[model samples]
Target: MRTAVELSWRLLRGGGRRSMVGSLLTLAAVAVSTGLLLFAVGANHAFLQRAHADAWRHPGDSVANPTAIEALSTDYVQGEPVTIIDLAALNGDAPVPPGMSRFPEPGEVWTSPALAHLMKDLPADQLAKRFPSPSGTLGRDALVHPGELVAVIGRTAGDPATTARRDVVEHLGATGGPSRIDRFETDASWSADVYLLLAGLASVLMVVPLLVFGGAAARLTVARRDSRLAALRLVGATPGQVVAITTAEAVLTAAAGALAGLVLYAASVPLLTHITIAGGGWFAGDLWPGPPLLAGVLAAVPLLVGASAVIGLRRVVVSPLGVARRETPPGMRAVRILALAAVVIAFGVAGGGLIDMGRAGMIVLMVFLVLAFLAINFAGPWVVALIGRLTAATARRPARLLAGRRLVDDPRSAWRTVAGVALTGFVAGFLALLNAGPSSGGPPDELRVAVPYERSAAVAGQAEKRLAGIDANVSVKRTETRDDPLDADGPVTTTGVVTVTAPGGTAAVDRARTALTGLVPGKVVTTGADEDVTGDRLLADLRTGALTVLVVSFLIAITSAGITSASAVLDRRQAYAMLRLAGTPLSVLDRARRQETLIPLVVMGGGSLLTGLFFGLPFAQGFGFSGLIGLAAFVVLGFGGILGAGALSRPLLRSVTADPAPRPD
Candidate 1:
């Protein structure tokens, strides 16, 4: 073992410029893959943290012996949602909320840092006057994200605002009445669930491509490594010694790369916090995956690299003479095609909803989706080999012919060059067709507020008196009930709705809205536009998430293409030298190299895109004009990125073929 480690260190340090370059390239690839994987995992953790933080606002079943009463409502200021939680202690022993140091005195309010900042910018009547002067600021544990707007106000038990009444429009998990609770802990809101689902899907999409890239990192400069190992076997080195040397070299390099990746992820956290989701930007701590998960990722990446390196050693280990003679391995079997077909068939059946499994059905669909994604890996090489054979049979140019023979000689290597782009193409297709339908528009200038059913006439009279001085046509009416557009079957019972027609537009609307603030305790004054805010925000969030996923995928794809293309040049240096000596032009070889990546990229990338569209059909509404535009843009960008990556390696190819003289390993 000691001898093998010493030999490995000596070889790595003394292997000249080519070997050092290969090692550096491998390190860079592993670093990129590791950093991306951490980011994907961290995103999932961030969403979960937000969910837990937001859960306190949604109280669960009432306690038998309650100590406090809590009522939740929402207010809108400058088009942003502000969650207001009204609380009254029934006893001195009532439990304190998550971020408060103690139970609040009546009329006291605590605001999130973001809300306090907004209050400083806006006039008192516009926002600050809606609540009593903020007595304290809520801690991070009480807020979903750093930018979330939340306020906790203390009220007397008999305060009108504490009276039980349904909201005009239901926000997430709003029950429309005060709940008796002994504690703040509860399940997360439905919006959190939606965010979580999207996060999980994004993680899966990113993780698969990153894993593929990481494994491919082990195969960089495969030809050189294989020859060097074969020479070791020819010199009578024991198999165990050979394995030890390979493991030491691969593991050390991978471990160093993994550490570098850890640093990269850590450095990116500040930038990641700027990405808004669910109407707020993240807290720095939200993006940190704790020690256990971080350690696991660090260990897992190096082990994966080591395992891949060992797996690629079969030829040298079993038939050293054949490797020394430079024989091409047997072609990959058709079973790869069969395996892919089986997975696709299974996915189709599962997605068809043959059974009424409910939540189980969703789980099954997720499983099939993952299998289908991985199936692309199994199918890619087979498709490349088939493309090579067809190209070889029909190619008329030297560039095309050389490209075909190289693809046939090593389909796996060829597949690696395009795999990232192909995967990203699938992501683009899946996201492109999903459109959140248009917002349900309403009378933009109208303001509606819900009051207690028993006091509808009284509240309406009070509202008229309060808004009498406003320079607008304000009408107050008694409304028996208002139906929740989100929940068609559940109608919220309210006493009255204050309707304001502001001829002066937004300024007048603001005046009317201010006049009606605190008219009914515990009731929110909302505009007709407020009803559409949630839906519009959801759509906007989805678009943002889709863009984020596509950007990350493209980065990975482009990085993979560039690295693999350059590595392929290193692997085939000797071959390029021989071809140059045979009088083949560098231009021809460069064209051949580009064709090798381009041909498979178009064929497999298109296939993957179609498959993604097929999978997304269940969720897609008709494609809007924007959707089509986005789809076209993705295609252009995907192809352009791969072409650019392949082009980056042209200089390396020129250098390799610049010298045609042969050299020993």
Candidate 2:
């Protein structure tokens, strides 16, 4: 074991340019992997901490304000939706909301940063009309509007207790559902844990692409290492000893890489502290992983790396004859299609039940996503081989023919170079669905209506009675909106919105609301036209998701492309050098590399989209043809990205072409 360790160390320290380049690649992989893993951990931790802080900010079981609460939700704040929390308790009884330093006194209302931006120069009274008055319009102090920030207001102007109580009882408590004490005395309906889980999910998604890059960097030179080990075996080393030597080398390299990664992670943390997440950026202390966790991660990565190395070498037993000549891998088989088919079928079955999906359903869907990802990976090489055969059969040029044969020769390695973009494209299909949310023919027959939380139940009855007097034929289709906080552990605001859909057009909505205007109290936004509101929302989500994918996948692509180009050239230098001697042009070789990346990119990227659609379309029946547009856009972006990655090998190809042919011997 000592001898094996020493030999491994010596090889690591001095194996010529290939080893030097491979070491750098391996180090880069470890650093990136460590950085990504740590980032995920930090991000997850930060999200939870922020949530917990929010929960603790107003840690009461229920609200205890004396004045009646009239809560409503609206999209009036900075184009992002916000809950307009109205609390009109007498004097000292009005409690502060979370994340705020203090509660606003009688006439003053605290506004969220978003809301404050909109409050510019409006007179106090005009501002009050847009937002709620603290107690009611009677005993008013100077009109003080905090502007466009998220707001907390009294129900009426700064009225005394007697006036405030009468107003609260008159407006929110007309139906007498629950006493004021009963409202704030009970625990909030939802749990904060849900948000944490969501944060974890985001982290998991982010980490997947990072690992893909790291793994590609770490493993690109495996073939050369195997050849070296084969030579060792030719001398007399047993397979077990060879394994020990290789494992030690991997551990040593991985450990150094892990250490370098830790340093990179530490350096990047300050940068993370500046990027806002969940309404606020994290502090350095907030994102720091504890020593034990850091140590554990550092310890675990090497062992995993070592194990993977051993697994990779399973079929690589060294022999004198094998050392002299490499073995040919098996051909792509038709059986590979079953792997993709199984995932698609499983996704379809799961998605069939994913409508209005509950927590369990979401979990099942996420599991299916993971399964689909693995299946795509497993099927990738086979699909590449298929494309290769097709390409080789139809190719009319030497470059195209060479590229096609290369993919057929080593489809798995080729697949690795472009898989990140493929996976990212898979995610784009779902984004397409988001961008094309539930399409109902004309301007989505939905009206978003806000009402006071206290007499919320009464709004329906009142609307019915009033609408009956005007037109009984006008039906209201309402969707119940539960006031789940924006995220788990987010502040609890009782404000909610109910969607009232009138399929009978804008005129029907006017007719229906004309009667309810006298009875149902609160704000109603017209949604039958100017439907970009939904587009704005879905587009925002899409942009955010796309940005994350683009950054991570691009990183993976560049890293993998660089490493793969070097590794490929190293593997075929003798042949390439001879071809150079025989007068093959550099441009032809360059085109070959371009085709190698472009062909699989088109194939794998399309396959990813198809797989994503196979599952997504089942859930996207509510989405219209616009979803197709999103899918098209995603495929185009992926194709552009892969081409960009292929272009990265230009310098390497130039250098390879420049080298003179070696002696034929």
Candidate 3:
């Protein structure tokens, strides 16, 4: 073990360019995977942390609607759902609510790091927006930004001892008379569990691609390694020794990358804190992962790498002679079809019983989702084999014939090179169908509104008064929604919506919306209409979130194709050299390699599209499936895959063809 580790380390530092490149590629792949996995995981944690922060911002206070004019000047702080929030006074003169321990004083205020970060660092003129003072005077401008702490106004300004006891003289201007103070924050329409589930699902998508990346990293220079290990076998090194040495190399590379990834994550905290979600970016502290999870991530990455490396050598370890005479890999079995068929039947049976997507049904759905993903993996090689056979039978030229023969000869290797691309396409296709689904976007007749949670009565009065002025005949209804946590099919934190009846027409409804806007200095969103709200932000984020994983998968697919394609040529250098000596054209072999990649690109890409639609159609919401968009995406991916493989195969083709070197005995 010691000898193997020493040799591995020595080889990593002292090996020639090819060996060094392999090590670097392995390190790069592992680092990228680790960093992204952590980011997804960290973002999940941040969502919850931000939620808890929102919950803690007000304790013991159930009513958030303001009744006084003093806090109104600076009271309009934006909230999680982007509503205007008015702080209340804990002043002795004002009648305080029984539920409140203490409220913020007139000039005192609380804010998250995201808000403070956005406001504090600007010029003196802009600093005024950080905490607007009713009395035109704020304390000295802050030179340094606070780290993770919630920015508190009046910390350096207000005299807490005297301010709470100070007299409250009534002053009415554009606003009405001052009354009792109350504050309430809107609870997320859905529960934490739903967001948590979404985060988990997103993480799975990212982590799966990364697992493939790590696997590819382990096999970076397999053919060369096989040759090197074969020479060792002939020179009396035991099979176990060879495996130990390779595993040592993979572990060292993976460990270095994983550690570097942790460093990168730590460095990215400041930036991550600025990604606006919910209503704002997360606090720096809110984004930090706990020690146990961090430790687990660090341990898991290298172990995965070492295990994959060891597994890649199974045949070699079992028989050293067999390693030297590696055969064309076997094609996938017919069992892949059975697995897919079983999934469809199970989905049908379970769909019938699980009519309502209750907790049990959701659990079953989750299982089906996992099965669908696995089925794609299981069924991929089988489809590739069938495509290969079909193409071979149909081949009319040398390039096509050679490519078809290669696919049929070693379908598993071909599948390995392009599987990531296929999976990415499938995932992308399924996601596109979401927007196509019926219930995804807002409805036409409903208008979305975010009124003060406790100001339901006030909002109704104001809304009615405004609507009465409008030339159009429109009425507004206050919408209240409640979620049952125990119900699996239940709604998550759903945003409240106002149903606007434009009895007059669309023009009348438009006039009514204008009147409502003129009544308040706040935002109003209309569902099925043009209105901006948190849902828009959340959905946009959800749609793009998978893109990062897809990109990582694409990179891995390209890298794997390039390295493995180059290795294919290098592995058969002797055979190519002999062919060149017999006057075979370099272009012929070049075309052969291109054909190999092009054929698989078509086969795998088509299979991916089919699979995506299979899963996506059954699950699409009331929104019609966007078959056109999916088709376009599939076409683009297919073209890109083919071009990428052909491009990567070019440089290696030149080197292998240009050199007619003798093979080592």
Candidate whose TM-score is highest: 1
Give the CA lDDT, 0 to 100, for residue 406 in model 1: 94
Name the weakest run of 10 consecutive residues (lDDT summed) in model 3.
166-175
Each model's TM-score, in the order given? 0.94, 0.67, 0.69
Error of 1 at 140 (Å): 1.0
Q: Write the per-residue lDDT of candidate 3 for residues 286-313, one digit (tens) a residue.
A: 5667778788888889999899888878
**Model 2 lDDT at residue 608:** 83
Which has the better TM-score: candidate 1, or candidate 3? 1
**Residues 420-458 of candidate 1: C-alpha lDDT, one tens digit per residue:** 988887887878777766576767677776555676667
lDDT by residue for model 2 over 442-486, one digit each (tens)? 344454545556555566666556556443332234344445646
What value of lDDT does candidate 3 attain over all alpha carbons?
0.56
Alpha carbon lDDT at 399, candidate 2: 97
Ten-residue stretch with the least lDDT total in model 2: 138-147
2 versus 3: better TM-score goes to: 3
Q: What order do candidates take by TM-score, descending?
A: 1, 3, 2
